[model samples]
Target: MAEQLEPETILREISDLEGRIEELRQAANMPVPDLRATLDAALVELELALTALRTMGVDQANAAGRSATAETERRVLRTVFQDAPVPLFLLDRDAGVRRVNKQAAAMLGTSPGYVSGKQFIAFCDLPARAALRSQLAAVVRTGRRRRTEVRFLGREHPVDAMVTMARVWIRGEPDPMIVVAAGATAVPDGPADDERPTRTATPAAGTAGGAAREAAPLSDDRDDEVMAALVHRMDVLATASELLLDEPVFNENVAVRRCARLLTAEMTEWVFIDLTPPRAGPASAGGTGAPGAAGHEANGDLRRVVVMGQPDEHGEETVHSLEQLAPEPGTLPHTVFTTRQSALRPHVEDLDLLGVCADGQPACVKMGATSVLCVPVEDGDRCIGTITLASRGEHGPLDLLDLGVAQRLGRLLALVIRASRLYQRRDEIAVSLQASLLPQRLPQIPGVEVAGLYRAATHGIEVGGDFYDVFPAAGGGWGMVLGDVCGKGQEAAAVTAAARHGVRALSGWKSDPAEVLSMVNQALLDEERFVTAVMAGLTVGGEGMKATLASAGHPPAIVIRPDGMVRYASSGGVPLGLFEDFEVGTQVIELAAGDTLFLHSDGVLDACDMSRRQFGQERLLEVLAGHAAAPLQEMLNAVEQRLIDYCDGDLRDDVSMLAVRRQPTPLN
Candidate 1:
């Protein structure tokens, strides 16, 4: 009934069956049929032969299809895992590795096969095992994702791991599938330790068979944490940038102290800043030593450690300077000088200096410090000084390269210092000019208690454009103008002088506040310059204490009642030089007996602290309310002190406040 098969066809069938059997064996499974037995049995029973052949063909076709599908799936999985950027691993419910990608295997310094079935704890170092174990357990119990960091004992780097657990169904039964993605958080600073196995230089190539597949969704909730950390760092750098540009405090010792304290807090260590001269000896010998010092005495090699802070200390403080720390020949200073490298001096040992040195002193040293990082301060070709950071206790040794951050910080410090010095020189010139322009003292005025305070911004290099004048009007009342130009430096100062003289000269002709401001503004506008100001005329009369005010884009004066209530008389007007047709506005206020009025420059309100919070108008009113009853001088002093404190003792603009109090005539 059935046709006989050819010898060649039968041989081909046998070969195909043998190959399938071999593939099944390789996959750790067994084949179902033997080709020779099936053929021999078919020949012995002719009728049954047809039926057996039909069944055998169907069975072989099904087996062949399944084998091809399984192979394709395995290939696809391998391709997906290998191409992943983050390290990935699959583990059993017991935390035993089932499979790991190339990256994970590389990170663990082992082959995937060797890692398979091994306990996860076996790869992690002591410091990381406990945390990882806890996180893994939580993920498995909750069927959720868990994130952690692990430090492998033998590896030089640490890895951040994200683990998620899911139920994998196999043959209608559920099994645990743990997915992990790991990435290195920091680069290793040293050589690998002996405790970890060494990895091969090249990984074996995977056989090509199937298309790459997609990875499952990440379960770890680390995106927010990472982004927050980055944002916080960016903000810190921005604040630092603004602080560095501030002229007045940039070079001040206190400024440096604050910067060091900031670094200590951010980096979690103590910081020390030093400013030493380039070379040792007197200036005559081409060194920066103090004048008239002996050459052999190391005159020019001056050292000054301006700021230092220990985390254990209550607050930021200064440490020893280079001059104080200068040791005898062949000692600490000499060693540092000769070495020209950073020194790490641990608490238990003496200082070890590292770097290029003509003298044979060690470049890196450890003293009583548990950890220390030191770097030399270099400006171009010359070596200026050194900065050091130290930590005690179980924190471990310092990473010198990591301290390059401090070095970058030091460079910024140097720039601020240089700028501050230039600002100081300019200030001296401005102060001289301002002194020549202003009257030596306020003119005597009856029935009015007048006081003025001029406080320069804590950080600027030049004197501000703010200026005030108090002189008797031609008729009788007192004439005063408080004004500020739009900018800083010599040009602004020159304009300020011109405006002030113009007001004084104009008051001789015009007694009205609006007329005086109009004349001044016209003069400035004619000169094509910009300025803002407020002018006021105060007179005592039988009717009441009369005051007339005019403004050119300046803040209105605050009038404080004797009962401590304060009101602002702010009739607004355009700033000077903005337009040719600008008109100054005037308002009249009758001051009751014992009332006080305060006029101030906008710099007072613009002052901001390190946190960027402003000392606003509301705070100014509160201060005035609190000190209304005090003497004019006392009130101004208290307000100035509060402003200074609010700005954290560093002002970026000039402040001028003038106070006038109308005291009731005493009963005679």
Candidate 2:
């Protein structure tokens, strides 16, 4: 600027001046030289072409830095998209593919190079294209993620796909929509776009579609309903379990009835169970007909048949034979009879096949059942029976789970049945033992009318412990004894026999009741076992009947005069086996003519009612008073009836009574 110079030289000088000013401004706080000043200075060198060089150099440097940054960013993005497993794509403002990764290309059955610049709809199959359009538009407007499933048409087949949408921003422009896709096969039936967003669909009214699908709002709302049903099933099973363990109600028939009722209620249908033996005749002969008029053969192998659901018009119950239900020779019912086990027939023309059909006919024109399931009821290792469940109307046949439950139920029923039979056998054995041990008839004694009664306990199979004896005494009087042992069964019966023999042997030694009991006590103590007993000796004299009674831990005897007056002979002593020094206590009472004396074992007072309340001594005494003046047998019968009534028909202990009456001297 200080000298007149050539154009190039002038431009160089101006440039130098501008650089100095800028550097000074950086060192200080002054503003840089203005662009206008530089331009005006450069114009002075317009004839030299120096202005062009300075301007071009600055512009070139700026472009090079920007190009380097853009290249680095593009390289990083390409690597990220290529390695990602999920299908990824970038779309331009016009919803055209700007970039597509390998995953997306493979899904669409095309390459990235071919896919780029193509409209997103052009890549999708017809059904999915419409859906993608709707999803992208919604994503673009809302700036939120949207998702759907679609089917992409491949070169040779179609692939299921899951599409996701969200907004993405590019440099120097508003954010445009981006779409990512995945693939799945578990979609419900519809067009290829079943899971894909429809072309005209609006944005869903909530958060991301992924959140809604994962949580499944409708399914969550119905959870309680499903759980309630599960709880009800569990409750029913628990109730059945309780009933099975209840000894009082564990009857076979009762269990069967309950199980049938439960099944009927649960399935909402009629149920029929026929416990019958297997057929030995030809299948055609035994077909769907009433069992032969003759009762089942005594020697015939018997099997149980339990049929659930109502039979056809001909009334054929769902029948399954034991042999058909068994798995192998020795196996549990549930394990052997699986759900897949079935008896099959090709046509309904055969009688055996017809018998199984719902119509109970051998007509071939009718629609025949495809399969039938039979579950065997096994007890231990032997197949006792079969449980048959049927499918009717339009419902599919039973599966493994259904048959499994039935087999389990059959096993439970078998247990109940076996237990009941065992209980009955035990009861029979107990009654037989008691009858064999006790005296069936009483011996006639001089000057005395005696009647005796013995009743076994009704609780279970157990030989009774009650016993009574009427024999001659030393002084020509009758010795009567009644006593109860402490327990039941063979052991108690053995002790009872010992006690009776000891009393009879002692009667020969002395007439006094106390001396007789002393002898009996010594005899019982001599043996290993103990006994409780009451003994009475009555001698007929000129004036009246004189009686001496002794009790060893035995209840007192009751005497009823012919005049309707009642009295109790109270005598007590320690039970047998208490000590070697123990003694029998005695009480003497004169019986007027026609007086009757009653002696009984403690079992009479220990009887229990249905409510578990005992028929105490007070109740027995009152009963004896009411029947005081009746005939001996009538009095015994009346007492029996009253006892049974008071106990509400439940006798938990044995009862025995011996009655002795002094007849009026025949009025001689």
Candidate 3:
């Protein structure tokens, strides 16, 4: 028989065995053969010694009786848990549901399997989630039982309940488990916490209405706090809405930056707005052609567009650094975008959650992030980007209320982004269409240096109606047309195209400038749009160039002689498309060597400054006369620069100009 050892002696042997095992574990780094085998043998010996100590001097009947008692205790505990009067839940350290008793499952209106592994706080009302989360965290941090009032959201109406959480320690488990028991509390007839007013009046003691009001309890301080928070959130949203809609011209850069700043002011310490780039071509599935509703496509990455934080001396530098660091895979922002879900970490354990910064440091650590929240910027069912909020020093960790506000704000921002991209696409198309309608390269006249310039209005997004062309006509002559349609946008673009192409086609059949203008007017009569134009037919000669000029209610063409002499051609008839019988004014002009004929739209004379003073025809004449000897292209550029300076670059209309200079005949 084995010698029976005292209890103290057995405990001392166990302690010695533990010390030996620790020493062996520490020696694992050494270059020893069969180290794993030696460790396994030692563990087996420890287990056998423990068994011997338990059985030492104990009869088989007594050991069996102890085992039976342990079994009965476990069964009793299991039965109490499943049939407990109140709902009971078992949760892991992270608040993940490990198990739920039958009563708990029934209270949550779900089966145990369905509720397992889900966050317990997710079953609470949105406004209560943050508070409940804080309570659970307190219970874990202090290892003390905690109780809080929460509104569970699974029933027809929100059920008010009191939840109590206590830590349970089980052998062989590294961390304590959380046991949460919930009991139904009184359901108030008043509004919910979020809807309650900031201040509630106490009813008079004797009046009937007062007594009835007192029957239902007034809101407590917690409800008032929630109401204030809701008010603040609504105020922020109102300001954001105004910021989005207040500008007539939505500058996407300004809007995005402003929204980020707004959130930093009221929501969290740091704000990051990232966007998936707009896909080229038509929008993909579920796309609505509503202005800028082009769906954004994600290719596993997001572009950070806005970075906002507390304003300080190093704020700009910090922003620049963060902007340079795009969120990487596994980072909070990128994870949110990819998963199309919101992520709220009340305490940031992962340092690289925000990705690495330009200084080769974890972004979250560099920003001193205590909490982080990331939500998708969604367009309908598609996620276009993400908005990430971080709480740093002096700012408490973010909660579920912040998450709710951010999600709503994200939806608003998505719409703004869509509109911005839509207008951007429209501007691009306008530029391309405007380029396509004009002559790419001017046809070279025999003795003439020809140049043209067109400028769209700075105030609007629509394509201007200004058009110009310098094309080779029949009979070795050149036909030049500079015109302005009455309106802007696609409608005016159609008229401008018809008038430009019509003039080119008409000049092919008619050699006289007046005849070509008349034919163009006849075609445009049915277009329901008016056009003002000056057409010139030029022929090279030994002396210089012969120009036949015809005007259809257009600005007079100015003739600048080599000696600074300025002459304006006669004003013409009504604007084209107004009357079929109107006659265009025709003038024959002789361009001596070094002479220039300058034709311009009314926009040149109508350009205005801050004082609303126009840079009129007199200024135009002065510029032309001053630079008359310059190269034709150089002179036109000087005129445009002078106009820009006069108006401070604020153009109210489209400016179009065509200059034809007869160069001196070559001395061969």
Best by lDDT: 3
Error of 3 at 526 (Å): 1.9
lDDT of 2 at 178: 67
Of 1 and 3, the candidate ahead on TM-score is 3
**Collision count for each candidate, in order:** 29, 3, 0
Ranking of predictions according to TM-score: 3, 2, 1
**TM-score for model 1?**
0.45
- Please list the C-alpha lDDT of all candidates, in the order they appear: 0.58, 0.56, 0.72
C-alpha TM-score for every candidate: 0.45, 0.53, 0.66
Predicted candidate 1 versus true structure: per-residue lDDT over 1-668, tens digit per residue: 22234456456545633432332222221111233333332332332334435534332235355456546645555677667765677766556787887667655444578667776655553223323443554344334465555544222233333333342312221333566666555434432343221111222222111221232232243344335434644555566667666543445465566666766655434555555432321231232334232222233353445434442232221132222343234543344434556564322122232221223212211111234565555433344455666543222233333355556665566555544444455556667776655567776566778888887766555657888889877687788888888787777778888989888888887899788777677777755558888888988875358889998889988899988999999768887766877788688989987799789999899999889999999999998999888898899888899988888888878888887777787777
Runs in model 3 lying further than 4 Å from the true structure: 1-228, 284-300, 310-321, 350-352, 356-361, 666-668
Worst 10 residues of 2 by lDDT: 197-206
lDDT of 1: 0.58
Stretches of candidate 2 off by over 4 Å are 1-236, 267-300, 303-372, 391-396, 456-460, 472-477, 505-512, 526-529, 540-545, 606-615, 650-652, 665-668
